[model samples]
Target: MSRIAIVSDIHSNLEALVAVMRDIEAKRVKKIYCLGDLIGYGPNPNEVIDIARDNFEFVIKGNHDEAVAYKIPKRFKRLAAKAAFWTRREIKPRKRPGYREQRVRWQFVHKMPRSEQLGTWLMAHGCPTSNLEYIHDNETALQVFANEMGGSRICFLGHTHVPGIFTMDGGEVHYMEPQDGKRYAVTAERAIINVGSVGQPRDGDPRACWVLARSDGTFSFRRVKYNVDAVAERIYREKGLHTSLGDRLFVGE
Candidate 1:
């Protein structure tokens, strides 16, 4: 593949997922990787899971995926924990005539790995070591950089629902704001890149986000606009999902 498409935190929004898929197809990108969170906090968890399993070449397990596949952890907040529990029950196999087997989707999430290393990059749901941890701030980024064992030159992660780049030069970490289609060089300096969230974004932007990594060691952040209102309405119509999930889609929080 000339470009490897990377996406993460797709919390079951079909509209956003479709939109991102369309963008990826238009770019003629074949190989794709997912940083999990395939289920929870949105409508159509099964559909999202199907897309991730069928399309993405590599997948990393996120906190929500772990919760749904095994047990919900106490680390999740009230709404997130509720959504994870709801999704666990929602993905149960049922007698739907035209639909694919729900058990396959559950199995897909169950088989996800917490981290995967490819070339010079390490893919993870949150960070390299912990899936529940957040690298949104500089302090956390510093710790993550400190824990680096010199195996991977770059770490691609998603959990904070924010798209940005963190570079470590001479033991000092620096954060850079990411823009759509903006490409950055991956040098010998250690770096961590968040591909952002596909279903739910908390970076004050409602657009679906992803990343494109070229063979030349350059990364481009991409965002696509999707129908948030339609997805939000579907979330409201779906049973067991909280209305706040729908509310947050509009604000991207």
Candidate 2:
């Protein structure tokens, strides 16, 4: 049996990453898949990237990753652009020292692919139409589902930051609510699972994030609480980050 642990949207929060890794290790998962946005909106960007390099089994690129590597368009939501710009700054601080190393690391993140398949799952930060598309609900997932998966039966996505699962077959779609503390069976062989965010979770629940455990033909979702207060404190001390970004961690809204 092969067990895989899936995580996404780490956002450079090292504390959260550590907690998630500890928990994932406890489960003894052999493979770990990251759905992208590995850096952004958090402190310790360089350290987090380094750790991902050492640990993650597979990594996919997200819009934020693209923004840091390549020049993202100014037309792509001004607020998002601002966040991505700020994230780049957080990753690569100048004058003090280590700026060059950070720049190189950012380049490494950009090198990540937009989509990839591992085992039976296709991983992408968002819908296949665009790496930035958010898959938050059934209607949206259905619209992008058919086109995104193409030949693959299962597509795992991030970008929504909300943990959810949606399956579409024969033009009919079904929504699976976030699992409750246990691994939910994959049930259908062909399905799409959104692994959710690792650092930033906006699913109304204030836990670190969600992970999918896949073995054979069954998959389960598990939530593990990390040091939210520690991450919040780091964000607060980190200069130039929008205060609201740090504030949202308390409620996980």
Top candidate, metric lDDT: 1
Model 2 TM-score?
Answer: 0.90
Tens-place lDDT per residue, model 2, 71-175, is: 776656665566677777766546667778776676678679888866556778888667867778778877766566767778888888888878766778888
lDDT of each: 0.87, 0.76
Candidate 1 lDDT over residue span 70-133, tens digit each: 9888877888888888898888666775335787876788889888889778899888888888
**Candidate 1 structure lDDT:** 0.87
- With candidate 1 superimposed using the best TM-score fit, by how many Å does residue 107's alpha carbon deviate from the native? 1.2
> Over 4 Å off in model 2, which ranges?
75-79, 92-100
Candidate 2 local Cα displacement, residue 175, angstroms: 0.7
Query: How many backbone collisions does model 1 have?
Result: 0
Q: Count clashing residue pairs per candidate.
A: 0, 2
